[model samples]
Every structure is written in structure tokens, then in C-alpha cells.
Target chain A: MYGMISTWRMAYEGVVNQFERLKEGEFAGNVLEASIREIEDFENFISVGYGGLPNEEGKLQLDAAYMNGSTFEIGAVAGMEDIKNPISVARLLSQDRFNIFRVGDGAKKFAESEGFLSENLLTDYSKNKWEERLKKVENEELTPYDGHDTVGTVVLDKDKNIVSGTSSSGLFMKKKGRIGDSPLPGSGFYADSDIGGATATGLGEDLMKGILSYEVVRRMGMGLSPMDAAQTSLKDFEEKLERKYGKVGAMSLVCMNNKGEWGIATNVDFTFVVATNEQEPTIYTSKRTEDGETVIEKAAAEWVEEYLSNVLTRQE
Target chain B: MYGMISTWRMAYEGVVNQFERLKEGEFAGNVLEASIREIEDFENFISVGYGGLPNEEGKLQLDAAYMNGSTFEIGAVAGMEDIKNPISVARLLSQDRFNIFRVGDGAKKFAESEGFLSENLLTDYSKNKWEERLKKVENEELTPYDGHDTVGTVVLDKDKNIVSGTSSSGLFMKKKGRIGDSPLPGSGFYADSDIGGATATGLGEDLMKGILSYEVVRRMGMGLSPMDAAQTSLKDFEEKLERKYGKVGAMSLVCMNNKGEWGIATNVDFTFVVATNEQEPTIYTSKRTEDGETVIEKAAAEWVEEYLSNVLTRQE
Candidate 1:
């Protein structure tokens, strides 16, 4: 069976667009890359790729990673700028045995040398948002960080291969050269073709503390259902963080076992997209119950429409 | 109990120098930082800090990480240049709640903002070595990558607070902005106050594929002896990598439990420094047996003398 699961409502269209190729027995890596590229190229997705928000220095530095479960080959880039498709670059780097992880100017140089387009990625919409946020921080004592919706996807192919990828501009108005979990292995993403794969989107600083993605995948490997793996890992880690660090930030994870079964867990109202051989491409929203379980439901028509309108009508 | 274990014989002096403070019941974080800082300051140690080798562009980019086991606070820097003590910078970053991991220019800026000294770290010895290596690569087509002896240390204080830190110059002649496992949590180092902590040194690319540091700590938490945890994790990962990735790189790990028990494992003849309440600070060499267990013995006086002479007598 073939299936794909990704974080956020922004991934719904990409999953829908890529389902045909996945059903046609394409490799998991190619399908995952193509799906993420669609989101990266869309200017409306302010948290990833082309029009993603800038750092405190007004530079669009992106972080992305790709992991091939079958080979344990991982590639990643962080603090990269002017790279049109960070996900594609990460996938290309995964083919190399060394220097697979690059950062800052080195990442930019490698991407450009390898023929990935280097262009100005900052759109006016994002720039205006940065400016407005900067003013509020100066005048209102507000925090300058928000909007870290990373596009993380995990795919299982007909050949039983699993691959996971993640792309993010990181926390909006973050310090220069700041990176999140998007580019980290085990924390941001983990996959093992024989068992399953998992990807995360949330406060990267807190996420890396538990290596939650790897935990989810490991639990699945140990006979836990995908849903149980995702929920228990997230809940346990969050509680541990609260007791230790005195606070916890938002966190959401998505996982899929080799059987095309998928699961999700989140502390906030999080939307995700999933499609499988037994299920149509669909968007779902998830929230944590009081008992620390996750409640997942299909996105209502009204909610989907409202989300789309918000993206389409967003302005400075 | 108080204890410290560090990769490489290069750390012996630091461990020796810091044992007094550790015995006095200093906090684990302070002792770990001070011990690593001593290594970072020693220009004779070519693999880390002041005399560390340069990247392909003749730039000295360094990587380091700091983790507090009790709070699960992690801070790291990769591809950072001109910072005298990256371990100190990492420790300082761990105190923050966000943007704890910085790379490249951002790391430098953070270091400078925090009053970390900014100065040329490339010594004449390191520069001449880089030039000589460049000639050998051009003349003989030899791989320019070597000398990745990261100084990774794990310390447990009297209060059962565990802290782990790592510092490295990365692979000699690596690509600009290339980073290994040194700065990434879970892969390079992992610590838990109640259980144990582990740190790695070797081919970071291969090491990261296994997330071996975290695996060692997890095994210890599961009630394995420190030796069993370190040996089994390294052996299992090396075999798995050989099967999947076709080859394994030289890798070594050092770990310490809260009870001051320490263990070590390596595919090569690896030397490490350890001091604990039960054992005096001493250097030991370890190698893997045919059966995949580790054989560790106190380093001989002749071997220690030769190692020091080799460092002191090297000339251009």
C-alpha cells in the first residue's frame, strides 16, 4: 500500500496533487520531494520556501532536510538563503556520503553550484509583515517570534520504502542564523522503511529535547500502533518538558507505519493532510484531549474554506 | 558521586587539571565547561579550538554543543569561525529558551555579543599543515579529509547533575560550512542526570546515521551497565551501517553514569581520559574484540610519552 501524511492544511493540495504519482508506484523520495516543492513554490505559504518570512535581519534563511529510510541516508541545510527549493537541495545532498549537511553560505554555495536556482526569495508581503512585527516589538514589548509552520511530510511507497522531508523558514523574525528542528535528524524527522517514519513541526528548541520523531518511529518498530506511538511520545515528552524546563511550547507530530496506517498528535488545534490506498486524499484537524489522547477529525467544509480564504487574502 | 569521561588522550591534561575542582563538588556544568575550555585553549591539540584545521576554503570553522541533563536544555553552534571557546558559547546559549542553536555568522555574532573573544584561531602550525595537505591532494589524489578528533566530554557532579559537551574543528579540508555530528544533539552528545550521558568522536557523518550517543544513554537508562550500553550501541550501529551504507567510519564513544561508572567503545585503537570518585584521572586505550565487546586498559607510560612527543616535536 502507498500513503502520504504531512503537517498543516497547506499540505492538503500538495498531497492531493501527488497522490496520482504515488498510486502509479513512484518512489517515495521522488513523490515526497515533488509534493514539498509544490508548497515551497507557492508564494502564499509564508512559512516555507519562496515567500517565507525573513529573520530579524530581514533575510530569508531556510532550513530543510530529507531522509531516505531504506539506506539511512540523510541530507540537510540550515540558514540557507535565496534557494528556491531547499527540499530538492536536501534530497540531492542525500546522495552524497559526506558533507551531506551544510549551513549558511556553504549551503547556499553548494545549492548554487549544483544548479539549484539562487534568487531573491523575499516577497513584499513577507517584508511588510517583518516590518510591522519589528515595530510592535519596539513599541509594545511583544515577542518577535511566531508563525513557524513547517511543511513536514512522510511517504510510504508501493515498494514499501519510506522517506520523510521537512522545510521551514524557521521562527518568524528569528535571530540571524537561527535554525529549528526542520534540518535535524531524529528530532525533526526519522524514517525506517522496514517499520515506519515520523516528522514533526513546532517549537524546534523544545522538540529536539525529546528527539520525538525518532521516538515515534521507534515505538512503531516495537509493535505500537502508529497512533499510540505518536500520542504517547508527544504526551510523555511534553509532560517531561513541563516538569523540567518549567514550560512547554507547541508541538505536533505525524507518523505512518509501513502498512499505510497513519497517526497524529498535537497540543494545539493542528491541521494535517493524509492519503492512502484505502483512504482518499483528505485534510484533518487534531487536538489533544484532557486525558492526553489525540482527537482527530476530517476538516469541515467551512473550516477548509476559511483556511483557504485566510491564505489567499493575507495582506500587509 | 562525581566523574568525568572524555574522548582522546588529548583530554587527559584537562581532566587532570580539573579534577581538583570536580572533587570539591563543583557543578557538573562548570567543570565540564572548564575542562573542555582547557582543551579548546591548547593550540597543540589540532582537532579542536585554537589550532584546529581549516575547511576547504582555508577557513577554520568549528562546531560545539552543550547539554544540561536535568533540564534537557541544549545549545549548539556549527560552522562558527573565530570564536575562541565554542564550548563556553554553547553553555551560555543553553541558558536561553529559544534560538539556542546558532550557525555560521550568527554564532559569531552571539559569541561577540556575549563578550566572547574574537581573534584569529588559525595558528602557523595549522596553516602550514593545511598547505601541505593541499599539495598532497593535488599531487597524489588523496582524500583531503582526516584528523577529526573531536574532544567530547561527559561529566556527572556530586548532585547527580550530568552535563555533556563536544568541540571539534571537523574534517580537515571539509567543504565550507560542512558540519559533522559535533553540534547536533542526540547524535554528538546526550545527557540525563538520573541515568547517564554519552559523547562521540570520529567520522561524524557515519556517527550521526545511528544517533549513537542517544542510543547509549537510552540503553543505560534501561539498566544496562555503562560498558554494555556503549559497546553494544557502537557495535550494533557499526554493523548496521556497514550493511546499509556499505562501510563504516572510525568511531569512538565515552560515557559516564550518575554513579561515576564509565565505559568506552571504539572501532579503532581509541584513547580516552576518565576521572571519578572511585577512580583517579587516568588515560586508557580501548579496542573492539572479535566478539564485539570492548577491551580497555590503562595507557602505557611509553605510549603516553610518544603521544606527547609527537604533538610537541611536529614541525613544518
Candidate 2:
């Protein structure tokens, strides 16, 4: 019962592209990496990979992580620069028992030494967007922070090995060297082949405050269904954050148990992609109900088309 | 009840220095910061702050984090260089709602912009130690990585406000920009004013795989005694790591519940300092038993004297 789930509409094509290989019995880690690399290579996905938005300093610093559930091996790079595929670097680092999490220039140097290509990551589209946002921020016309849609995924293979990964350029126009939950274990992603795996996408600062991804997976381990775990953890943490911190930002989580059952929860209008042995890759929209539950349904054909087209047109 | 517990015998003086202010009703965050700052200023402690060991590049890179249990606010810095008080920077960052975690040069810049004085963190003693280790590592007589003792602390003030903080130079001779669990939330430290707080010190690479600190605090929240929580969480994670990753590293944890009760667990001979309204600041040594329980005893006068003298002599 192979299965995969990922945050955001941007992951739909990547999931679709990888389903065939996964069905052919590809390892969860490889399939997860390939799926994320697809999103990373696409220039239209402004929140991840090559063309992602730059920091306040106009540099494209990336953050990514990969975790092996069976071994509990994790590797990550935060504030990495000039690396075409941060996810691959993270995957490589996971093989080491020490210094698995590297940051900044050191991360870049490690990737380069490991033969990962160092390319100029800033595309004109993202640069223009950054410049435009910088003006508005200077004029106080808009807040400097927004658009942190991290691409996070969890995969379970035919042999039941599970893996979770996340990649992001972090918040648009964020402070230099600022990193979100994308590169953090437990907060951004957690996986255990024996139970399930979970990944999160949202305002990383607030998300890290709750370690929502790990909580979702932990709840699943405690006998809750994947859906119940996702929804209940999100609801509880969101309420706790609101009461304590006075405000809560956007948070969405996706999870899949070892049996290939999947779940999702979100506090805003959100979209995700999922594929399983019994189902083809599909796009779904989700929202939180007033009753502290999640409402998820297959997105309409038109809505899917519009979303994909919007992503493409943004490249202009 | 005002209480504080910090990892390592090095923290004894700092805990003693701050107990009076804590008893006088200083806020938990302020007391935690002040206590940690005292440790950071002490040059005798080789694993943290001033005179801390350097990375392979012969540069002192520091990591630190602060969390407010009441507000669930977190701030961290990783791979920062030339910073005198990383704990203070982390505490200041906890007040921000975004971009609270910074790394490398960006973290250094943030601290400088905040008016933190920039001083050379490396001392002659530390530099000489690094040089000697470099030769031994080159001769293949020793592994490049060792000595990762982070000063982690948890404080419960008179008002029951809780806070957790950690500071470290990371693994001695670690790669440049390598970070341990010290700056990462949940792995290094976790706090909830209504429940408890926990902090970790050891091989961060292994500690992060289990997220033990957060798990310990979560167990305490689930109604376990602090001792039970610490022992069970560490024991479980250590065994899991051994099975899955082939081996586990030396790990030690210190936790304090909001009621001022404290607990400790360690896979190695470890020492920590604690002070509460009912007890004066005192140092204790702890180790895990074969039966998965912790054995803690007050440090012998001879052992304490020898330890302090050893630290002082190392500076020569």
C-alpha cells in the first residue's frame, strides 16, 4: 500500500510524475527526493528551489530537510545558497552520523564539495518581485513577511519504509539568514515507518512554536486515525497558540499512516496533492470547520486548471 | 516556588549567583537569561561561550536558544561567530513574532545591530587546544569530533513562569557551520509554563533524532513525574537509537516542572546544578541505572574540588 501526500497545489504535478516510479517499487526516500526535486526545478514555484523568492538582502537562501523513518536519520541545510537542489544535499547529509545539519556558507561549501552544482539561484521574476516588495515595504504599504508556502511531503513505500522531506526559500523578503520550519526535524517533518509520517507548511515561526508535524505523527502513534490525528493536533495547537501568543498564523499539516491512509488539517483555504496504490494522483482543497474539524474534498476540474495556470502565468 | 536547574557542574556558580534575584520575584525569562549569561562569561567552561572551543576552521561558532513557556515564544541562533552572549541574543529574539531563528553571518549581524558587543570569543587556551587536536586528528590518532557539552537550563520563577535556554560551541573541531540541537527547538529545549521544561546536552546529532527534550516535557504534561518522564524518555530514545542507528551517544537531560520539582537522566556520568526555594544551589552527579532508572547523588567534596581545579588548570 504505497502512498504519498504533500502540502500545496504546487506538488500535484510532482506527485503525478513520481507515482509511476513509486508504483514500480522505488524506495520511499528516492521517490520523495525525486518528487521534491521536480518542484525545485520548476521556476514557477516561487516558494521553493531554483526560482524561489529571495531574502531581504536579495539572496536566494534555501532551507531543506530529509528524514529516514526506519533509521531515524535526519539531515538538513538552512540558509544554504547557490545550491540547485537543497533536498538532495539534505539526503546526502543524512548518511552521516554527525554534523548532519549544516548551515549558511558552510552548507554551501559542503554541497559544492559533494559535487552539488552551485548555480545562481535568483531568477529575474523573483528578483523583480523582491524589488517591488521592497518598495512597498519601504513605503509601509505592506508588511515585509508573507508567502511561506513550503513544499513538504511524506511517502510510504511498498515495503513500508517511510520518509518525510521539506523545502522552501522561506518567507518572501524575510531577514537575511532567516530560516523557517522547513529544515527542522519534528517541527517541519517527522516520520516513523512503524506508525506514520507528517509534514507541515505555514508560517514557520509559529509552526516551530508548536512542533505541529511531530505532534500529528505522535497522535497517530497513539491509535488515532490519520485524519483524527491531523485535525486534533492542529486544532489543539492553534487554540493554544491563540490563547498564549495572542495570534496564530497559517498552518497546514498532511499525514499518512503506514497503511497508506492519509489525513490533512489547515486553518486557511488550502490545497494538497495525494496519491496511493488505490488512487491516482489527485488535487484536493481543504479548510477547517467551525467545529474544529477539517473539510476536504476533491477540487473541481476548473479550480485545478485555474490554479495551475495561475502558477504558470506568475512566471511572466 | 522559585527554582532553576542547569546542565553541568559549571553552572553551579551561576545558579548560586541568580538564586537571590529569582527568589526576589524576578521573571523567569530574566532569571534564565542572567543565569545563562553568567555561565557564558566564565572562561573555564570549555564547551560554551567565552573560551569555548572552535570549529575545524579554528573559528568559534556558537549556538543558543531561548523559549518562553507561557507564550510559546522561541528564538535561536546557530553558527554565529564572535558573539559574547548568544543566550542574551536568543532571549531578545523571543520577543519578535518572525525571523526569530538566525544563523551564521546573519546571526552575527543581528546581534551586532542589537548593540551586542563583538569580542574575540577564542582564548589562548582554546586556540592551543584546537591546534593540538588538529595535529592528532591529522595523525589519525583521534576522531575529529568530541566534547559537545551544552549548558542547558530551565527556570521556574516565583510566579510559576517557566523558561528554557541552551548555549554551546557545538562539537569540538566540528565542521564550520555545523550545528547541534543546541539552537533547535524541541530537540535542545522545550518549556510550557503550565507543565514543565526540559533541556539536553550531548551528541546533538543523536539527540535530535529522538527529540528527547520535547518528549520529556510532553510526558510530564501527560502526568508523569518529572523523574519518570526524564528517565523513560531518555531510556526509550537511547535504546531506539542503538537499535536503529547502531549506536547512541552520551546524552544528559535536566528538567523542572512548574511546581519546582526537578528530574535528571543521563547515559553518562553527568553533573548538574539546581536551586529551589526549599533548597540552596547544589551540584549533583547522575547516571542511568541498568534498570532504566536514574541514580543521582550529591557531588563529593573531593570530586567537586578536583573538577573545579581541573577546569581552572585547563586554561593554562
Candidate 3:
């Protein structure tokens, strides 16, 4: 279970295809690694990889983190420049216990030592977007494609070892030195073999505040099913933020329990693709209740129960 | 409950004293804001305030976040420069609901608009440290003081409201724009009025990954005592990291419940000062257990059980 880090329904298929490949044993080792690398290589998804949105200065900076639940070891990089596939770099970096994290020029230099290639991540589409954003930026005008929505994925391999990860160009026009939830373990992603795995998208800061993924996996460990965990965590987070910030930022979470139950929750009606078995990937859309009691938005208390019984369970 | 944002045991007095002032009606509103300002203005602490350490480029880049638990409203600034009291800037920023977070040059610009004074945060001591660090950095030398250990504070005010926040100079020579858990919510600090509040110090990255403070408070909401919650969260985090990385980073948590119960937990033997109405700022030194069970670095689980049974019972 994962997200385009956090994109619309239309962007889900590409990754869903990657999931399908994984299901077919197209490759070995960590499929999450392959999945994210493919997404990063896919330039059409500008929020991550080869053509991820650049920082405020128009320099493409990347952030990625990966965790292997079996070992619970993690590796991360932030503000990593020049690396075409940060998830790959993160995977490689995770190999050594000496330094599981790196950033900036140091990360670039390390990638070179490890024989990783470097490239210009900005494509014509991203560059044009940047240029267009520059024009409106000074005037504080906003764009829907703020160069963003992270690309995060979590795969529960056949061994039932749940590995979770997320990589992003980060929010559009973020500060040159800004680091989001992407590379921070537990904040952006978390996986525990005894419990489950979770990956988050949407406002990185809010995700950080909720420590959403870790919280989900922990809740699952404490016995809440994946669906219950996602709904409760999102509802609680929204309430926590609502009292102070009026309206909460848009964010979402995806989860997979050890039992194989899967779920997604968000502050808005959000969509994610699931490739369970030979089925062509189906987009699951979760809508919050009108009373705002459950998960995404101000969800209703009974929404997830209804949604799961009426919608998700049927899909499974 | 509070922390020096991870300061020296002695420095804890200053903030504890400020808490006393608040108790005696020596000031108005949250004293956390004032206490942090005092710490930031103090030149002795290299991790925060006027004499805080600089980035690799030898510029002081600061990060801070403040939250009023009563409202659950949060405000933060990252990579902010030329500000002596970043916590102050964060405090002022928290007033306007328009923006809950900001960063870098944009943060500086916002601080200016808010009439916060600008000053170089570098001191000769910090400059000398950075210079020596530069000499050894090429050799990849390591030091315990990476110029970070946030000065986090959380106050359960007379009204029993929880307000928590943190400020930092960031890790020594961190990537030019690197951000630690200091300015982000949940990781650096967290407070919820009904349950309790928490603040952390030590390895900011590790703290962020665990989001220990919020987790602790949430555990309290789940019915664990303050000490129990802190110990369990820290242990779980350490175990999780140990499985993947062999050893864990240095970090600690301080917490308080609405019942006026307080506690501190760490992976190392740590001490913090506490003062309440009748208490004269007693220093509590929590010793870690050999097998790592208690609150405060390898603490004896039995110790917390006794303390909670004695102190917390009286508080209520």
C-alpha cells in the first residue's frame, strides 16, 4: 500500500503497474526499491525522481527514505542533489551501519563513491512549471501543481516482511534547505514486522506532527485493524490540529496490516491504487461522512465501518 | 513538565526559576516563551540563542516551534537567520493564524515584518568551535556536541493548559539548510491539554523518527502514567532502531500530565530540575537500569513504579 506520495486518482496507475510487476516476481530482493526507482525514473510524475520539482532556487533537490521491516533498519537522504534515483541511493546507503543518513554535497559525494550516476532532474515540463511559478511566486500567487505530492510506496513481500518508504521532490517551491517528512523515518514511513507497515502523503508537516505512519503501525501492533487504525489516527490528528489552525491541511495515510488487511485515510476524499493478486489495479476512493466523524476531512465515527463493510471488503 | 530543550543540568535552574515566577504571578501568559528567550540570549549554551553554533558555511541558521496546547495551534520557523531569539519569532508567528509554519529567507522576512530584532547569533566561542570543527571535519571526526540538543520547554500552566515548544541552532555543520526535529511538531515537542505534554533533547533525527514526545503524551492519553509512557516509548524506539542499526542515537524525553505528575526518560542517565508550588526546585536524577527498563537511561522499571505511586498520588 502507498501513494503517489500524494497525487490525484489519475496518477495511481503507473505505480499500480509497478506493483503488478512486483506481484509477478518480475524482480527479487526488495520490490519497494524497484517500485520507487521506476517511479523516480518516470519523469511524467514530476513530484519525484528524474524530474522532481526543484527547490525555491530552481535546483532539483531530492529526499528519500527506505526501511526493511524484517531488520527494522532504515536509510535516508535529504537535500540530495544530482542523484537521479534517491531511493536507490537510500537503499545503497542502508547497506552500511556506519551512516544510515546523509545530505547535501556529502550525499552527492557519497553517491559518487558508491558508483551512483548523477543527472539534471529538471525536464522541460518541470522547468517550464518552475519558470511559470517564478512569475507568480513574487506576487504570492499559488498553483495547483505546486510541483508536488510525494511518491511513497510500501510493499508487503511474500515473506510477509513489510517494507515501507517515501521519496519526493518535496512541496513546490519549498525553502532551498527545507526537509520534509519524506526522509525522516516514522514521520513519513514506518514498518514493523510484528505489526504492519504504513506510508504517508499530503502535508509533510502535518504528517510529521502526527508521526502518522509509525502511529498507524503502532496502533495496529496494539490490536487495531488497519482500517480502524487509519480512521482513528486521522480523525484524532484532524481534531488536534483543528482546534488551533481552523482548517487542517490536506494529508493522507495508507496502511497494510500483518494479516494483509489494507486501508487508506485522509483529510479529504482521497484515492489510491491497490494491486492485490492478478487484478488490474483498482483505484479505491474513500469519502468522509457529512458529520465529519471518522477519517479524511472531519470523518464520522461510523464512516470507516460502513465504508469497509460496504466498499473495501467487497473489493478484497 | 519540560527540558532545557536538552541543556546542562545546571541551566535547568533558570527555566525552573521562571516557572516559579509564573506560579507567583511574576508575569503574564506562558513563561515558556520568556524562558526560551532567556536561554537563547544566554551565550553559554551553544545549541540555542545568540551564541548558537553556525552551519557549514559559518552562518547561524536557527529553527524553532511553539504550540499552545489549549488551542493545539502551532507555529514554526526553519533555517531562519539573523535572529537572536528564534523562539520569540516563533511565538509571535504563532499569534497569526494565517501561517502556522515558515522557513529560511521567507521566515526572516516574516520576522522582520513582525518587528523582531535581527542580530548575528554567532559568538567567538561558537565561531572557534566551528573553526576547529572545520579542521577536523575533513578527517570526518566525530563529536558528541554537533552543536545541537534543542532547548525544548513544555509548561502545564496554572490553568492546567499544556504549552510546549523548542528552539535550536541545529546540528553542527549540518547541511546548509538542514532541519532537525527542533521546529517540527510531534518530534521536537508536543502538548495536548487533556492528556499531558512532552519535550525532547539529544539526537534530533532519532527523536523526529520516533516522534517521542507526542507518542508519550498519546500513551498517557491511553492511560499510562507519565513515567511509564516515557519509558515505554523510549524503549520501543531504541529496540526498533537497535534491530536495524545496531545502536541508537542519544535522546531523552520529559513529560507532565494534567494531574501535575512529571517525569523524564532517556537512554542515558539524565537529570532535570523540577519546581512546583511547595517544591524548591529539586533536581531529579533518574538512573538508567543495566538492562534498560526505567525512565532515564537504562532506568529500573521499579523506580518509576515507586515514584509514580508516591509523587503522582500526592499531586492529585
The per-model lDDT (C-alpha) reads 0.92, 0.92, 0.70
Query: In terms of TM-score, how similar is model 3 to the real structure?
Result: 0.78
Candidate 2 Cα RMSD (Å): 1.2
Instruction: Report chain A TM-scores, every model.
Output: 0.98, 0.98, 0.84
Which CAPRI level is candidate 2? high
**Candidate 2 chain B weakest ten by summed lDDT:** B307-316
C-alpha RMSD for every candidate: 1.3, 1.2, 8.6
Name the 10 consecutive residues with the lowest summed lDDT in model 2 chain A: A307-316
True contacts kept of each: 0.76, 0.78, 0.16
Q: Scoring model 3 with DockQ, what do you get?
A: 0.17
Tens-place lDDT per residue, model 3, B160-279, is 677788888888787556567777677778888888888888777667657788889889999999888988989888887777556687787888787767767887666565555545
TM-score of chain B of each: 0.97, 0.98, 0.86
lDDT of 3 at B56: 77
| Order of the predicted models by DockQ, top scorer first | 2, 1, 3
